[model samples]
Target: MSVLADFERVDSDSGGAVLRFTGNLSLASLGDLPDRLDRVDGQVARIDLSQVARIDTVGAWVIHRFARDREAAVEGLQPASRHLFDQVVAAEHPIELPPKPESPFVHLLAEIGDAVFTAMHTLYGLLGFMGATVIAFWNVATHPRRFRFHATVHRFEVVGVSALGIIGLMSFLIGVVIAQQGAVQLRQFGAEVYTINLVGRITLRELGVLMTAIMVAGRSGSAFAAQIGTMKLTEEIDAMRTIGVSPMEALVVPRTIAVVTMLPLLGFYSALIGIIGGGLLCWVQLGIPPITFVQRIREVVPLDDLWVGLIKAPVFGAIIAIAGCFQGMQVEGDAEQVGRRTTTAVVQAIFLVIVLDAFFAVFFSQIGWI
Candidate 1:
């Protein structure tokens, strides 16, 4: 067992106080010594370690702290103890507190700036990706044998054929709602017969293509991102490069071409189904026969409206495919990034589609398509 550390204050020959320590000054023997030292009030000229039988790092730290706080000189330490004490003193450093937090208003402004910068960076990257896609398309155009026919056909089924049931159902419901609401408002002014015009024109010129684009953005766009992102995570994309296969030609081009070709057909189909639903609703509520309704639609809805919708469809499809594939190609690091990119693909596609639709609307109106 080690002797407990003890200390006594004495008058020194130099006419000043000295703290004389005794016993083994180790961690186990240091009980109450630190507290006793802290209670010491008088001026301390020196700390005497001559009678200490042994010492450890903990003991050195305690002694060094007391000596430092009192500005007293240490005396009679053995060589090893002196070396340990010197090391303890050398290792001591001031603790750094955390920096103060910024004000909420400043933080909000910083966040807004960061968001704007990120959006600009994303736009630049999307433009670069679109250029790459166009180059890939040119390559395929130059070498027709390089096209992946089976992959593109499969994508056609996935992006177009498989979506028919849900898209048709949604469009039918939208048409019924539009007819019903238009009838209610028109009936107020005895203009209920104009409901046919409302349903036909809106379905063909705006709602039909716009709604189909939104659905495709949510469905096919997200699928492209997830599929490509998974391939990237599994290093299949890298392996394709190793095998001299171009990912852009093999994967991206097929999907892009599939979407670009199928979207117009799907939009037209959606518009036709919506018109049928409106006709059914008109027959049920207003007692208008299907033949009369069809005749009225032919007279009221012009060829210009159908042309407008068709013109927008391919552009919306291209935007959806490009956004999705671009986000997928950007995926790196982990599986979580795949999910984030997939969501971003859908949102980005939808946002761009709406913005372009608005631009198309303005352009068409200015050109007297209305």
Candidate 2:
């Protein structure tokens, strides 16, 4: 097709210049249009479209781009040509947008509001989950045969038995380090024998259960989220619901009970192992014999200290289980969501465990139990 188009300067005796459009001003006839437009570089005081026989949107756009900032007056446009020109002109000189500025205090307030809402929403979900779990337990209590015995046993093995070696080793190492450090410090006051008291009281009252809870939150809590999240992704939970199975009963209760049942036992075992490690360290490094260390521990460490750690264990276990299961239930069948929820479960479980531990400490101190 002939892409023929041209424009010319109409010399005017008046003060301003005029540009006259001639020939087919259409896309097909737009040859050298931009270059030709560039040639009309001087003042464009007027544009006369009356001589143009035909034009298209592209031609309209070319004219608009050329004349938009030139303050030129256009004349003799038919209705259709005027509409096209108006469209192109509006497009070329779009409305300018202004920026909105925010104060730093307002931004900080918005962030705080968002965080508070998120925390409240999480807490609400956890309460709902706890209620459902309680109902599931009630059902199992009445209909004993409906309990998932095999699943509970399996979880006990996974959450309890599988964790023993690492827990024991970590507790032992901690006890050894504390004893060694305590001996060095106490020797400054010629009271190195007090190392036994430090190891016994700290292990039985705080470190053993606290460390176990933290580890289990990272280990079993994440595992719970991953497992339940995978099941959620595969729609197994939905399928169970359709088949009249309560997911709380089938999935959540068994895991929760298993961990709750096993945590106190594990805490006791950890405390025992830690004390043994400390005793060994004392015997080897401080020249205090194992029997003497054991006697010292018994005399200095109250039975209440052991009870304090034991009491915290089951509560920590329940928090870990609920956090994991709650996050798992919230998963959206996405791989990224599964990973995110698993991480969230571990973090929330650990945070709650620590917070609960703190409250317990305060309560114990207030009641003179410390």
Tens digits of per-residue lDDT, candidate 1, 1-370, equal 8899999999887766999999989999999999999999878999999999999999999999999988999999999888988999999999999989999999999999999999999999999999999999999999999999999999999999999999999999999999999999999999988999999999999999999999999999999999999999999999999999999999999999999999999999999999999999999998889999999999999999999999999999999999999999999999999999999999999999999999999999999999
> Please, what is the TM-score per model?
0.82, 0.79
lDDT against true structure, model 1 = 0.96
Best by TM-score: 1
Steric clashes per prediction: 0, 0
lDDT accuracy of residue 238 in candidate 2: 93
lDDT of 2 at 31: 86
How many pairs of residues collide in model 2? 0
Clashing pairs in 1: none
lDDT of 2 by residue, 1-370 (tens): 4437777887677756888888777988888887878776678788888878778989888887777767788887888889888887776645768868789999999999999999999999999999998999999999998899999999999999999999999999999999999999999999999999999999999999999889888999999999999999999999999999989999999999988988898888888889989999999999999889888888989999988998889999999999999999999947899999999999999999999999999999998878
266: Cα error in model 2, Å: 1.0
lDDT per model vs. reference:
0.96, 0.89
Residue pairs with clashing backbones, model 2: none
- Model 2 earns a TM-score of 0.79
RMSD of 1: 5.1
